[model samples]
Target: MVLVGWGEQVFRAGLKGRGCGVDEGLRELAAPFVVPDPSGVAIRTRLKQLTAVDEEVLRRVGAHLGTLASGDLKARCHDGLAHDAEAWATRKRELTPLSSARWAGAITRATHEQWALARRCALAHLQSLQAGVHALRHRLSLPLGQKGSKRAPGGYRSRREWHAKARRLRVLEDRLARERAAWQAGRVHVVRGGKRLARMRHQLPAAQLTELQWRARWEAARWFLRADGESGKRYGNETIRIGPDGEVSIRLPAPLAGLANAPHGRYVLTGRVRFAHRGTEWADRVAVNRAIAYRIHHDPVRGRWYVTASWQTPASPAVPLAAALGHGVIGVDTNADHLATWRLDVHGNPTGNPRRFPYDLSGTTGHRDAQLRHALTRLLHWARTCGVRAIAVEDLDFTAEKTREKHGGRKQFRRLVSGLPTGRLRARLTSMADAMGLTVVAVDPAYTSKWGAQHWQKPLTSKNRRITRHDAASIAIGRRAQGHPLRRRTTPPRAHRSDVHGHRIVQAGGDAPGREGPRRRLPGPRTRSVPPDAERTRATRTPTTVRGVRGEQEWVPDSLLLTD
Candidate 1:
């Protein structure tokens, strides 16, 4: 039997033959690669100290532009597979009279982006449905109560489960067919205010919100106050512009142009926006007339307005893997509730004690994001203090693993896997680490936990220092990123008890002599009762046999008695 440790649980899997070992049937692992630096940077600053008139003007402008955006999105969706550049230009032309040419351009661009995102989501949904149908079909084909192997799930444990699964299979099949048809026809379902928030309208009590608050949030979410940047334009953007002096201004739509307080149909808010983070970069970009997009939005819960500035940066050259790992790395294992981390040396040996940065993933989206960011901040600080150049993490994707038909009754496991912030962690870490000049390396997630538990867990654990499976898995991740095998060293075969076939791989250098020899004897007695020289003394002891006597010789006592 082979024991596999998944998260905190260890499960036993039977091997087909006694000759097989824990390493048998393991999937090939992918090579570790450095996560490239983020190609875009976004900075947010609060828009404060606005007068009542300014707020009214801003609201009217945002609403007007938002209506235009909504109409454009609807038109784009209607075009679907038939959409072309000509159709896109025509939509922009229709909006230009209502909004300015720049505002129309931004709205049309946003519409195209939203439509593309919806298509991508539809494709993903179709793939997920296909996976579910395949899993359900595979399981339903087997006999009821049949056992399964490591690679695939078994039959249902009962007739009731079998019948339910059969029904679910039909449902999935129908959904899959519909999704496939929609994908082919380029039809996508998208909600202006997120689908989740839209549903909360019917469940206001459960959402802990009153009708007014929900309406406010919903409208705020659907508002399109974002404007794309254009090079060689005034202050890098013509629609929504923030001057180098931190003055916020917006080019109003035709209907709201009458509300403009500034020259040239632009409204300048009394509030100044200062981006404490990356302020210098934003100022520099504005001075150079580089393209920088800006967005203005209101948070209903906070009762505040904020402006976000974003711009794309050129992709940095890919650093060689060796250079990235030259100063070693901190391998991080992302869990549902915490991040498990451990530092390793250049040789892939773990250094110091393991550390865990805990964070709560339950609560509102903003709360969860804040918790995750806080945890990651602590982790990055620790890594920086250790002087490591890179952070290693598993490239985990639990998309297919979250299917109900795949895990069956293991609802807890499914939820656990689903709750893991694999994608978010990678994105956040890569972006954060890039600013700090630290590389993020992603390694294949296969067998890291299982092999780490088998090899490094207990050996690193002691009364003073307790190492969990996640900590051990961090070590495995670091080693894999450093191009080392997960196992510390390979053991010799039982018959040889030495490296007779070849030298043991992974731990020692090939140039080391006597690598296969028995361990050197220590300078003390092996046990309390045995002296240090006992073996030597035993070897020199005399033999009791008479060397000159034949095989059947009689006893010499008879001759001795006659002489007496």
Candidate 2:
């Protein structure tokens, strides 16, 4: 517990406060890494008295945190882009330099992605502005007309009328001219900034520009990054430098560096083997061998430390989704609190009764997550039992559409939308399904409900039991993913219907001269004689089921028979 608390303090200080690095000449600030002894006395040892194993742990923690911080920086840059887009489009405002203080500390330790993230956002914003200017100019260039102007009394019959008409046109023309000038000026300024950036690139080395000058140039010329190609993105040793023998190190900012007490004012950190297990231990093999990076995580409830090492490996070839979709697909219709599921064969025929797995989310986050995990476990087990290879799910996203204002601006609607477990469930499902070797296919959710209810309810139902609307929808989702038609022949054949109604009657038979029946036979060709009522109308346009040419042998309903 003491070691855990000490590690936590060091991690928090480095990530939230002045960031730490892995180098020599360690900073010697009052020792926040100091852990209290069993006697409750604070022990100050500059963290050097700790075993080499513990020191390595601290270093890995710091480096791992720095990488995660880069994610934060990327998010901030993207958010800035979104805010700028809204202001420009809705408020007619132009782009401006972001607050330097907000990004001051982050810029110093920016990763390759962080730099690219900012540059791309700035370029996109400038391009949007240019597009707006072009649209405005096109609107202004239309031939002058009295279409939108109020008609003058007497209509140019007198000097006063003519004067009034001319005056209105002039006023409108002047307003347009002013707008054009403002837009053109903004364009000129942005272009000029791009030229300046180009000049700097020629004058300075890449490293020099990368370190201190790029951010300045980006701010001065809002879209200067357009000149550079993303293929040149730097990673690996450039961003995260690791020495020979797996000695990882990073350069800390001044404030964080001063917190350690190593000689030469540098703080160096490394990876150490904690416990070995048949030469397959985490620190022995995982951390030191082919470790592209590491991630640190803490479980507050367990009070333990965990480091996940990422390794670079050759990509494994995966079977194509079509080939892997072996027997059939399991369609999962995700609702607010339950997953409605059904299975469909390759021919789009429902294989079994649908299932509903209910999960409760009325407690803490951990409790809700547990409930979801249990539900998914059961679902995947069922899929495995049925020998299903692919799971079809509706590609439903409510982030942008499920808004309070859209639902009558009610507070309850807003809360409900916020509480939806779509994101977590989708992520968990994808990961777990992949591990189980099940391919997940996302299908369009358009009209699944209406179409399913209209076409499938009666056919998929029995006299004693009927499938719910959601279960029918699940069937639709699976068929769509497999490229099968949704609607199918549902009504029984005319003869079958007659039999069911207990009103069957033989039709008056017609034996044509060339037809083949007990009474008539043709010499050249023979055809089966049909009753007058049984004979199908050749000109009747009712659609009937036709087999598709695909390997799945889909049943395509006759379009003429099916209503929209």
The lDDT leader among the candidates is 1
Assess the local accuracy of residue 42 in candidate 2 as a C-alpha lDDT between 0 and 100: 12
Q: Summarize candidate 2's per-residue lDDT along 409-453 as a digit string, tens digits.
A: 246545654676766777778767765777777775655665776
Q: Candidate 1: how large is its RMSD?
A: 11.9
- TM-scores of the models, in the given order? 0.83, 0.45
Question: lDDT of all the models against the reference?
Answer: 0.82, 0.49
Candidate 1 is scored at a TM of 0.83
Global CA lDDT computed for model 2: 0.49
Candidate 2 residue spans exceeding 4 A from truth: 1-288, 297-304, 311-318, 410-413, 463-466, 492-564
